[model samples]
Target chain A: MGEGLRGSIETTGLTMIYRSGKVEVPAIREINLTVGPGEFVAIMGPSGCGKSTLLHLLGGLVRPTRGQVLIDGIDIAKLSDAERTAVRREKVGYIFQRFNLLPNISARANIELAKRIHGNGHANLYKDDHILALLGIKEKIGFRPTELSGGEQQRVAIARAVINQPSILLADEPTGNLDSHNSRLVLTLLQDLNQRLGQTIVMITHDSEAASMANHVIEMRDGRILARTHHFVYEPEFEGLF
Target chain B: MTHSLVAANILSRPTRTLISILAVGTGVILMLIIGGITTGTLNDYLNRTMSVGADFILQPSGSTVFYAFSSAALPIKLADKLRETPGVGAVAPVLAKFSSADFGLVFGIDLATYDQFPGRLEILEGRNSLQGNEVIVDDLYAMSHKVSPGMTVEILGRKFTISAICRRGSVVRVFVPLPTLQQMNGTEDKVTIMFIKAAPGADVESVFRELHRAYPGLALVRTTDPSVLLADTRMPGLKEFRLTVVTVSMLISFMVILLAMYTTIFERTREIGILKSMGASKAFIVGLILRESVIISLLGIAFGVGASLIIRKLITTAFPTLQVDMTFVEVLRGSLLGLLGGTLGALYPAYKAARMDPVQALSYE
Candidate 1:
């Protein structure tokens, strides 16, 4: 883990309620959770489990009805909407399941958007051959999103998310639309990024196999955390005396 | 990403944008053509009606009802006396007579001295000779009466030959010899009015005072001043009618432009939203739309001005009497009016475009 990984994100008694006229429906209720920086965490839940809603709150895309979202000891709920958006733009990068890349711009331009939004000095800082070579998409930089395959588009989306070198990455079903092979490829890319760059990743997925790859797996039912399993893979070595 | 690219993108949707621009352009063209025609006619009418060459008009003062009805008249000796007055340059004695059959006034003037104030009368036939009871008739009167240059016409029981045809129009005048008019009126040393001229830079007021002192019996009516002549003649509500027509036309044109611009903005809502989502500022969007509108309007203005020039030439050639002077200032006024119409038309659309919210706009599809 990097030195910055000492701090993590925490949600304290978070509650989100949707109001329609006189009716009040709860999307999430009294959720408490902690995600360590640089840790690959997967949130698993069925539909209507508020997995995406929770991700939205953590990313500051939506405001919570109550409680606080803390990132590195700072409360995001206390900030204004514009300020929250700025914080999210600068600190959190999102990779959507559908690969929400602007259709008109090329693959390289998709990554350029993040740098422009964050007011970075170097627009082409991430346009280096190494980043494209790392993603195995160096040859497809000039291709538009429509020209690329589904897996290629997702790789570009991932590249766009990491181009800013954000402290935390929030992805909603990053591989939900892909085949098994493409899904494995995307997952391996996420795992490799976590191990090599110490990049934090919080992903929402339905597949248990995908969840098993994470350092921590969180399951939710009815907007409440049902179970959390922390696992560390251990490598076994042979003893010569034995 | 760059201003040029952004502008190019905004202009790339040629069909939709051109339609909006054409709406503005059509309105501007209509305004320019109508304004040009009306201004040209008004100027010509003013120049024609107000003849300022005649320095003075002699009329009876208090008891005299009109110049034609007056029994009192100025003697011919007053012309010689007015010539000797200070600042008086030249004096031409005129004998005024009326022809009841034509309801027109005749000024039997001295052919030798009539060159001082000809009053747009260009002799197209025989010379300006006042010999043998000959008369010069305006072209309008000659054409109406079917009288040629050598034809004889009896007026007030005196036989006279039409020596020449003067310029055309309803203010058709006939010039008979002064001695023949005296013989017809059966009076000697009798004249109607003395037309006078003053040297350049000579104050007409001082000249008028001296003329009035010299000829106390004659009224020193200063008809030479353009403003006084125009003021004295009532225009029979023609100006009001013209103003009403022009104002209503402009109002209709303005309404058309307003509606066109409104429709254009409403139709381009998606495009505007896309631009806003692309991080274009409110001012930038407004400026782009306004620039497009203004450019189209100016093009239309140029076309209208060019067309008007051709029309003016055609009209002038067809009717030589109609003097149409399309001045630079008038063309400038038309162009500026076009620009104003374009700006006014784009105001509402620009405001709507500027106030669009980026998020709502992006999701408008």
Candidate 2:
């Protein structure tokens, strides 16, 4: 259980292929990638370039057809499904494009559910309050997801993801559903937590502005990594692909 | 956290939840009311028979205890022979027939022979005589039919005046003269059953044993213990009836919950995916589904018990002859079976939810 918080990811020869009715379709193929501890990386690609597949593989949501995904020297690709779930539970948090907040429960309950899944029980209600405050959503904690704006629901999802203090946070188009204002607020919060809390984040987005906020940007095309860039100004090159 | 999540899930869809609850509740009601009536009727028959103050009741071998179903009649001369047995004090011969008009039995008993027992028919109103076209009715029958003394009621297509109204809880609610009923039925020398009483200081067990030896061809059933009366295997289809009621009740609970929870899981596919993505284990997902079912079952059980009690009271009040035994034990038993059915029903749905692929589930619309 002591899988500590120094999040370093290294993937060697990673590949994923879907097979259906005698036809083989490759989603991600032979992609070697690495991100240092505490770094914020963003992946940008057009549709079918395997950006989402890579993120799913990284978060252990889907098993790779071939390769090794080493998170802090532990290979999740070789682990059993249950063992991988434990690794995911212990180290990775996901922010989906749709928020995925349970609509039947309140924002506070959605956050507490992560703690419950993390096995912290009632011991961390005070800690959850602090996380809600950090995200500037303490007031809307009692409201259900149906009552919240897209931005607020994503914020609750973020609070849920990070409440367990995971080593890696995976964001799949975190600002995809929000307006310009909400997009800016969520991006700012992500960057704030990445820098101050030393949280490792890998985000996939079509927005160059959102990708520009990360410390590193990796561009993908045809199911492979095409280029990498450090924190730079938004270039028009990243905007037209998606 | 599990219970709260389950509660919130159920409360979110008020219409669906209520339908499930009501379906389960309806199952409970069927089990309680139908089963209660059957047992109640049998118990009432046994109690009234025992209350006749008879040590034993003699009937033909293999004759059904429910007199309506038993057409075999003992020869009236057998009563005289039974009276000659040592320690036998009195023997009352009764000729019984079921009247479709009242949906009950009409007993014809000799006044002198019936009055030999402690629960004799007390003449509450008109003359005690059962001479020529006279009838006796219980208070319940009198009140229900609105018949008073001297009112002529056609029984078996023959007109008879209500000569007396006796107390209720007797073997039969309606009574007629033995000789007249025998004459009309064309069975003057035959009787359905005989209530036998032992003389004072008589050893009743020995008397019954001796009578059993003498009347080896007949069912000399001892009525001293009420259990023996019910245990007599001649009562038609009682065991099968109870079993069918229980099985049908459980099937109702099982099928309703199975369908409700199965549909629920499919509707909440994306929520299940979200849970799985949040690192919820298989047991956690299963626990969530089963917890919701348990809550629904509990609500259904509560509704069922409350409804059953009200129904029992209504039935007993409106139809005084219907003895509905809604005992605490019966209620508890019905509740537990309903819960078991619900839990079992939810298992397949829970398993399906637990085994869902998170990637595919999250992709569900």
Candidate 3:
């Protein structure tokens, strides 16, 4: 793990309740969790398990009804909507199950949009072609999302997520829409990114094989943590892995 | 990258983009064409009136630039009195009437007396004299009405022989004998206005003041100062009429843009959600929408300007006597107003898109 103080997170009694008129439905109950910097954590759960909701909370996509969400040392739960958005832009990158690539723009444009949002629109600190080559998508950057396959779209989405070299990545089912062969390829890339960049990654998945790639595995049910498991994967160069 | 996104979004819906462009273009066209016609007609009238080389015009109190609207209220004796003034060089009495057939003013003047001015009618064809039951027409009106010397045409509901075809740029297109028009209108010995010239080396300002003092009850207007002639007080409801045209044109662009952008935001809800997840702020979203609208407005303005120029050509071709002048300042005003309306129209849609719930928007199918 990188020796950086960024990407550390902790939630103290984090709770979220949805209200529709007089009806109050709790999407997530009181939850306590902590993640250190440079950690690769996988959240495993079934549908309706609030795993996606938790990912959204970690990414600052929604405000919690109660409790605190701390990133590094700042409590984001107390920040205004604009402040939270700023934190998200500066620190968090998200990957969705459907790949969520804008259908009308080219793959390179999608990735560049992330850089623009992070206020590095005209900078060239991190080369994008190198990242696309690492993700095995350098040749397909000119095509729109609809012109690419599901696997190619997911690769572009991952490129967009990490384009700014954010401190944290919150991915909801990174391979849910891929075949088994593409799924393994995506998982291997995610693992390589986590190991090489030391970016704190929180991925949600239903496949055990995909979860096995993470350093830590967490299981959740009914919005509550059921189990926390720790494991290690063999470290090897990415030249022949895929 | 944001620019690419905006371009892709606009290009993706070709029909909607085109409709929006046409709407904005239509608004600009309305403003330019209507404004051009109003300004052109007024300037044409004022120029021709000034071209008569008259130092001052004497009319009844509260007379406007539009001589057709005025009655024969000034007595013909006023012309003799004006001619007798110390600085007055000459006075020509004109009884003006609106000719519906020609869509212009018809002037009645005594040929011998009207020949005293510098802009005296120079006959281009046939006899130069104008007498009872005889009419004189300018070259433009003569060609447009397809009449020449000795051709009989109707004027003031009476048939009169075309005695001559004069050069263009006269004060009026058609001319008749003063006694004939006076007998037809039962306004004998009373004329609509009197054109007065200053004697050589006479101070025009001093002459103007003398005339004003001599005729306290009448309205004496200096023909040299265009500003004085075009003053709002001199032209009733002209400013309001122009404002009405501009407001209506702006409203068209605003409403069309508002509807176009409103529908666009709803269609791109999921896309906006993706942007939000990518950490785009509300300001960024708003900027994106506004930028797209601005681009559309620019395209519309270019199209409108081109189309307005063509329409102007077509109008002038169809009616040679009509004038439509579109100055650069007028075009710029229309373009700026169109852009403003379009930008304002996108505000609500931009706000709605920026305020959308990211979670709900993401899940929207």
Preferred candidate (lDDT higher): 2 or 3:
3
Per-residue alpha-carbon lDDT of model 1 for A208-233, expressed as tens digits?
66776799988899899988878723
Question: Considering summed lDDT, which 10 consecutive residues are worst modelled in model 2 chain A?
Answer: A1-10
**Model 2: per-residue Cα lDDT over B99-185, one tens digit each:** 888878888889888999977887777777776799999898899889988999989889999999998877888889988888988
Clashing pairs in 1: none
lDDT of model 3 at residue A127? 72
- Candidate 1 or 3, higher DockQ? 3
For residues B1-365, could you state the per-residue lDDT of candidate 3 as single tens digits?
Answer: 99999999999999999998998999899999999999998999999899888988888989898877899998898788888898999899999999877778999999888888888998999898899899999999888889999999998789999999999998888999999999998999999999899999999999999989988999888888888788787799999999999999889889999999999999999999999988899999999999989999888989898999999999988888888989999999999998998899999999999999999999989
- Pick the TM-score winner: 3
What's the CA RMSD for each of the models? 10.5, 2.1, 3.5
Return the TM-score for each candidate structure: 0.57, 0.95, 0.96
Candidate 1: residue B278 lDDT (0-100): 28
Off by over 4 Å in 2: A1-6, A236-238
TM-score of chain A as modeled in candidate 2? 0.95
lDDT of 2 at A135: 93
Q: What DockQ, between 0 and 1, does each candidate earn?
A: 0.09, 0.69, 0.79
- Which lDDT tens digits does candidate 3 get at residues A25-139? 7877888999888899999877887899888888888999998898877788998888989999988999999999999999989988999999988767447777888899999
